[model samples]
Target: MRQIRRLLLLISAVWAAAPLWAEGERAGDFDYYVLSLSWSPTWCALEGDARHSPQCDASEDFGWVLHGLWPQDEDGGYPSYCRTPKRDPSRAETAAMADIMGTDGAAWYQWKKHGRCSGLSAGTYLGAARLAYGAVKRPEVFRKLPREVTLPASVVEQAFLKANPKMTPDMITVTCKAGRIQEARICLTRKLELRDCGAGVDRDCTLEDALLEPIR
Candidate 1:
């Protein structure tokens, strides 16, 4: 009994002294990215019945693009989650295949709309991307996005202004770029500018299809 107790104590000390395995050792490490584009009149001209229609135009604070990948550190090993773009099509799916290809596309679209009206914050976009990639890649690198995102603000501004420059505006584009991982970008176009920090102005509205881009 004494020998057994001594062995047990020795084992406990060794176990306690040993390093604790980190949960994110391979799951938390990851890189993220963002890319943005402006709406072109040619693209915006697309209407109902068109193969791919612009759901929202720059004037209405639209025209944003985002793409991402959870690449591995090893060369030529594309992200294990790359398949996310083709499978489940729903967040509920546990398989990486369904996540990368299916639900991610819808999630991107939702983020675009939500971001436009402030319903979705920048964190929302990053969170969705991370969640999607995590479901598949399980990267170990830190996945938090930078304070500023890398979006094509200039392009959005040019488009919105070309449509109506007389109106004051507040526009911003954010891009999130992480080495190795695919980039993700978002653009926000605002026509109404606050003359005063805490004031509002009259703005007109028209009902149009919530077209951002062709559902692809």
Candidate 2:
């Protein structure tokens, strides 16, 4: 009886803290967004021409593209599939997201997976995503980067801070894979300004020097 009671209390506590976990709430009622910017070259090297999309095209310079603007909680956990859209985005909608994100598949996936939980319409969510991405100021290192650059993930963090005065290291994280940086996650407030991502969102790279591969 004591164990059962404790478990019940724990469940109640989690339920009470809906905002922290992005659960038990309507869409758009949660915390800020994590504007995930993918290092396009990493994707190209990993997936190659097999995926065969505009984003993976060699002719286009997709250095760092908007992966998705995800709704994140105070904790690392985020909400998803809170609601389902009755229909898909129109052609115009897909086109609108092309430059900011990639293709219809990318836009629609973000819409269905993350945007739906945002409590905003597809248009509003995507528009906000684009706006949030546009607000970010890129670092010079990424623009004029060598074909293969290596530095600690924190080095990348410092570069961003130097470039954007309003930004702090706490507001962003670098995601790496196979000793290479896959993405740089920069968090923002609802107003699209730099904000600290809490402890839940952490730098998970175990590498000493994270490689930023070229956009070949």
Candidate 3:
């Protein structure tokens, strides 16, 4: 009886850990999407400039750039690097995304990490990503700033909410990194419709005065 009970307990333990072990094993098995729009100037100030990335070049004039379209689980976990039989995108295909993504490399990386989990082919995923990026209305107000400023992170969220009437407070979040405004993450359905964020993605930055750099 004791040996049988031990075997039962071992089985239960493995079952409980199944989700973690099987993460990214299946494709297209997510609840929703999180569209991350990164503040370009802030990224330059933090990391881009250091790397001498061309996205930070003064002539680039980038504002909010498409960071990634991540598939999320309602339970706050996300799948990534899932196994897929799709062919990788070509150099031209990734380069085309540079206008919105800032670099072909970023586009390729997003595909490798999050896009594979979407169960879509590389071309289809990139096309979906472009459509999703176009769906969001990036507020022109931020780009009009002639100089850097510091404001509550909530202000960024409000700007998005105002520009996109279909989006509510619960549907978007402002995140900060190294005391600078990082990204505005918006929740969306698989079809790209606005939706409330899940618990993990709902974490809004509490910075009362986060730095926002102007477009260079």
Candidate 4:
């Protein structure tokens, strides 16, 4: 009984001291942030079964969803899992950001894969992600993609730039998967201001024009 009590006490002490995402040597070692906003329809169609998100339920009028806030280096590289412990966000911890991140699997995977490297606790990282996602004003045309509306990358870029006066062409890049518009990735400084990502990061949407399949 004495040994068991001592072990339980030790476990509690370690958890309290370990801090959420700031434990390891690699924490806080990043350059910039990429706030990726995914079109809910695209995600529902593509990775629906894999992620099993609430957005796939088709109950609400879902538009763009927060994919992740990823930390990146100047060279277009990123670190994952870093030196953080296996700290997962509890239900209360994810409440504020769950609306955009999708309450199910998205939040958990993102925290483990990307947020762990941001040098913040799960709550802090999730709160920051919500802020980053809210910073950009999504264009109406993209809020609900027009039926059978296929457009060029430049057109989409222009719409966003016009919507967000502070956002620039170099700072936001449209991403596509299998010729379908997927996400809009915007580069931001550590302070959450728009910034150019430079030539190191290749824009994922290479096609001249991509199809925007309307959300079903």
Give the Cα lDDT of each candidate: 0.29, 0.77, 0.92, 0.78
Tens-digit per-residue lDDT, 1-216, candidate 2: 999999999999988976433233356756888899888888777774678877877677777788898888887788786644334567789678878675667888887678877877778788888888887876867877667988787777777678778887788887888888888788888777788896577664656788887665
Q: Residue 188 error for model 4, in Å? A: 0.8
TM-score of each: 0.23, 0.81, 0.88, 0.81
| Model 1 per-residue lDDT tens digits across residues 2-92 | 9999999999999999755322223223222212222222233433126343233233322222234222222212122221111223343
Task: Give lDDT tens digits, candidate 4, residues 1-216.
Answer: 999999999999999987565333486688989988887777777887477666777675667789899888887678787776546699667665668876646788888778888888888888888898888988887655557677776677788889899887789888888787888888988888889985555475776768776755
Best by TM-score: 3
Alpha carbon deviation, residue 61, candidate 3 (Å): 0.5
Error of 3 at 210 (Å): 0.3
Winning model by lDDT: 3
* Residue 48 Cα positional deviation in candidate 2, in Å, after optimal superposition: 5.0
Cα lDDT of candidate 4 equals: 0.78
Superposed Cα deviation of residue 154, candidate 2 (Å)? 1.5
Candidate 1 regions off by >4 Å? 1-32, 35-50, 54-61, 65-126, 130-216
The CA-based lDDT of model 1 is what?
Answer: 0.29
Ranking by lDDT: 3, 4, 2, 1
